[model samples]
Target: MQIATMTIDEIRVGIREQKFTAQEVVKALFQRIKKVEPEIGGYITLCEEDALQQAIIVDEKIKAGEKLGKLAGVPVAVKDNICTDGIRTTCASKMLEDFIPPYDATVVKKLKAEDAIIIGKTNMDEFAMGSSNENSAFKIVKNPWDTKRVPGGSSGGSAAVVAAGMAPLSLGSDTGGSIRQPAAFCGVVGLKPTYGLVSRFGLIAFASSLDQIGPLTRTVKDCALSLEVLQGNDPMDGTSVKEVKTKSYLDGLEEGVKGYKIGIPKGFLQKGLNEEIAKAIEDSIEKFKELGAIVEEIDLPITDAELSAYYIISSAEASSNLARFDGVRYGYRTEDFQKLDELMEKTRTEAFGGEVKRRIMLGTYALSSGYYDAYYNKAQKLREKIRQQYQEIFKTYDLIITPTTPSLPFLCGEKVNDPMEMYLGDIYTININLAKLPALSMPCGFSKEGLPIGIQLIGGEYTEDKILKAAFALEEELKLSTIIPEGKEEI
Candidate 1:
């Protein structure tokens, strides 16, 4: 069996059939990581001894004929921003370079409950602030498909691990398009659940109302399986959904899209959309039609408003959330400081990266006394309008389909200097976050250069089931299943 290419289901069944031992799987995993990590830079930290010990315990349990949890012996990678007890969680920033949390994030705790072995904390943009991994104070994540290209940001490291066959699943937080954009670039499945579906108790905040923790995986089914373990209410997080259901996310995942209604935004294919992406989306729409689903073009008149509102609201919240990093509590503190003011100023000025500083300044200005109503308050009103428009559409359509990105994965430095151009890369994705809706991005087609293109499916709040069913249908119909980058060394 090819351990590197195995899916979550395949690995579980393989272990049950005695095809491989859990220890052997971890050993081979470390061997693969040692060989490729230099080129891939997928993880910011590695936990070889702990992961192996967890595997050994699993093997011993199997020997004793004991019942195992859902994710028994499975290896998983976590994004650095999610807290892990006794392990450093840097958020790819110098401010928290050596900071270690005393407790695990709720998502990490849930993974442990299911018997998943966390390999390590993956890299990310500093403070989850950029659309490309370039903002990372540590290193940029190279795309697995082409080394010169970028793995899309904030969650770039989380997405890169799954694409490089380093891990079968990973967790990433999405504020704007962080999770979906990277997943699209890396040719994997990424899901952003409803805002309150998962707990965020231990997540270091970027934007409180907008940030959501979700999964990145090789297949749509794997995405659903991970969600099953990750989704639940937590008393620790007041925003977590209170009314919980025990229904399996995998129950109707394969039911197919026989009579579903899917909508295509009229503005999604406008100018600036790459020709290849446009063709791929058009092809995907026809495939959905052939599968017996009704597809239509609809207008989301507040589309532009959503983009404008997202920046204002997200920045305003980020300015407030990131203020706790002052020199008093923890993290980095500058040595060149006399009094309190100098210490705070020098600490923030020295530790924060250029992108993070830019956002802080922008957010501070938006929330300033004179401009509060002009910028932040108006943006909140626009947000309500955007949410209502999406509700109006979901009343008629079961899902909204569009290209996951406007362009293919570009060369590493292509848009680093052009901030506006970088933000436009998320045009198709940010609207879903603005409306607090559930969405998924899955592989749809490949460009002539073998770079992947993805299709986004947006559903009503808490309608992940409908979105997953449509994605599973398209995933099977397209037959672009579980793509691993070419030239990956065989393990």
Candidate 2:
């Protein structure tokens, strides 16, 4: 049945119709992973034994003629940063290399409640620090489209595994473009819901205020389905928004964007846009117009300062959140240290990666007494400006459209040494995170080099449904559903 190529809906139906047992589906995908994972480096830890056992239980439920959960028998990949009980949840960092959580993240519990089996924990940048996957202490995730190229950062492994068809759906945390950037690079659907929409209780924090857990999937419908399971409040997360309408995200997904107002930020394409990507964005705009959407050019003049503000605010939060990972607690401890102070200093110094340390220092310095207002406070004020700008725009536009990334996936090691170059890769995506708005990145076109190009559809806070509907319309029009990597045939 080519289980690897099946969508979440297809798999759910197949299982219900007794076309394939959940166990058989997991087994088939495990076999596919075995063949492609070496090349893709998508997973940090595969939960083979655990996933198979869960699959057996799901099959038994189906055999008993019992009603299965909404996502029955689906195999999913979770980014390593999200906590999972009894499974190694390394944030691709040396400090937590051997860390296993005592409890599952809220989303993990929710997925399990819906009968989804977590196949594995995917690799990510160390503590979700870098724009490229090179920051991982374990391994680099290669773009399935071109192994020599990066799969994008932080959530790179989640995107890569889905692109390789190793898992039908995967979870990724977007602190600042982590999910969307990787999804764009890998040519899949990545949706970052409004910050407070999904509970983040058990996600290992990168930047608590900016970090959000979302899904990366092969299709927009699958993305919405995962969101249905992922959204809602948890008493565990104080920041969770309980006022959101808790309904199925896929209820009216097939409704095309007939009377929607979509705006393209003029500042996004003002400069530094690749010629090819610019053309792709224009083409996508015309397609949306043809689909009966009201497309227009709008001004988001604050785009220039979003990246800087994001770095300051996010790093400041990161420094605070990561402070808990000292040697006294359960991560990695220094083998040699005499005093408590020495031990803490040495543990963090040795356990953390270069990027982590760099951010920590940057954050600490920003928050230091002498520089607080100049850096962190100023950044916070600028953040408000960015948010208010989006708020004003969303009042006029139903969705904001732009290129997902400034360029195609760069070759591995191309910009790893040049931090600025790597950071600039997220130019188009960071602002949405700062504003805590929902946005989705989907495949729009391919670069001349055969690499994928993505177009992002941004929504107002809690407007994920509208964004999904628009993305679905464009996804249908593009007809790029069958665009798999060249090597999937063998798997």
Candidate 3:
């Protein structure tokens, strides 16, 4: 079997049964990465030496007939924003260019506990700031499907690595549509779990309240598998859900959406949504209906306000959270500065990318004394209404469905100059984040140009199992094959 293309189940079973040594699998994946990485630019840092060493231990464990973890020998890529001890956790920005973390993020610790090899740290939009992956200070990550087009940000590298078959699984942080949008653009499965479902202990904070760490995988089952390992409360993270009533997401995953009440927002298919994406959602509704689900259009009490609110709230949190990056502590510092204030100013000015600076400014402005109530406070109020609206919908329906993105992946430079237009790409997704709900995005169909279109399933807080079930059922129904891209020497 192609080692890089194997699913999580296949790799675990294959490793357990010794179809191939874990060391061999790791080596083969490196071979694949070496071949494609120049073209795809998915990874910012690869742990081939460390990964090979870890793989040998898994192989030795299997030889001794020792019990293995769920992710034994599986090579999982990590987004750069998540800390990995001793590895430089650069958020694709110069600020943290050579800053090595002294401790692993909680999720990274979990991955190691399960024997999942840390294949590499994937590139992403700097500080997880932009909607398109082009905002990285290191290099722009191109979509694996079409190199000329963008992979969605800021988890674009996570999605691209999986799509290119460089890694079977990758973790992405979703603040707004970071995880799901990139997954949709790359035709992979990406999830944004209910807020606090996964520990955010080591994630480089972007928008703390809205940020969530989730997995991007080739299949819905894989997403569920990743979540099982990634979830649970952490003392280090006050936000990690402490009393969540958990269930097996994989148990009834394939049982289909029969007898389920699925809600579609009435008039949600506005002119802003792409024609092809709209058609795909309509088709998905029919598929859900055919699968014995009760699909109906329901009126949702929200609007474009979410787009404004998301930016204001996320930026405000970013302003506060990012304050720790002052030049005195760590990260990139200006070589020349006259005073402490001048040092902070020069370090920040020289190190942060344009997009990062932009958000920081917006956030600082929103939280400033005069504008606090007008921008930040109003955004918080809108956030509460969004949460209330989702709670009301969940009281009556099992799931809420919509197009994951308003449009298909566009050309790289298409919207970069227009920040508002770039922000509009996340209109369908930011609301779910605003409400801190669980949502999954997976392939439903492909556009005529062969770009993948994704359908999103939004569920109430902590209702990931239901969302996964519906996504899995629809995935099995559609039967869309994975399109692993062949890379060129250069973009």
C-alpha RMSD values across all candidates: 1.1, 0.9, 1.8
lDDT of 3 by residue, 34-82 (tens): 8888887888999989999999999988888888998999999999999
C-alpha lDDT score of every prediction, in listed order: 0.88, 0.91, 0.89
For residues 1-491, what per-residue lDDT tens digits would candidate 2 score against the true structure?
68667889899889989999999999999999999999999999998999999999999998798989989999999999999999999999999999989999999999999999999999999999887799999999999999999999889999999888889999999998999999999999999999999999889998999999999999999999999999998999999997877978788999999999988777777677888989998998999999999988888763556788888998899999999988996999999989999999999999999999989988998999999999899999998988998999999999999889988888999998887777777778888899999999998999888898988999999999899899889989998855788867566
- What residue pairs are clashing in model 1? none
Clashes of 2: 0
After TM-score superposition, what is the CA distance of residue 150 in candidate 2 from its true location, in Å? Answer: 0.2
lDDT of 1 by residue, 264-364 (tens): 88888788889998999999999999999999889975255677778888888988998998888899999977899999889999999998888888899
Candidate 1 displacement at residue 343 in angstroms: 1.1
As for lDDT, the candidate ahead, 1 or 3, is 3
Residue 102's lDDT in candidate 1: 97
276 Cα displacement, candidate 3 (Å)? 1.0
Can you give the TM-score per candidate against the true fold?
0.98, 0.99, 0.98
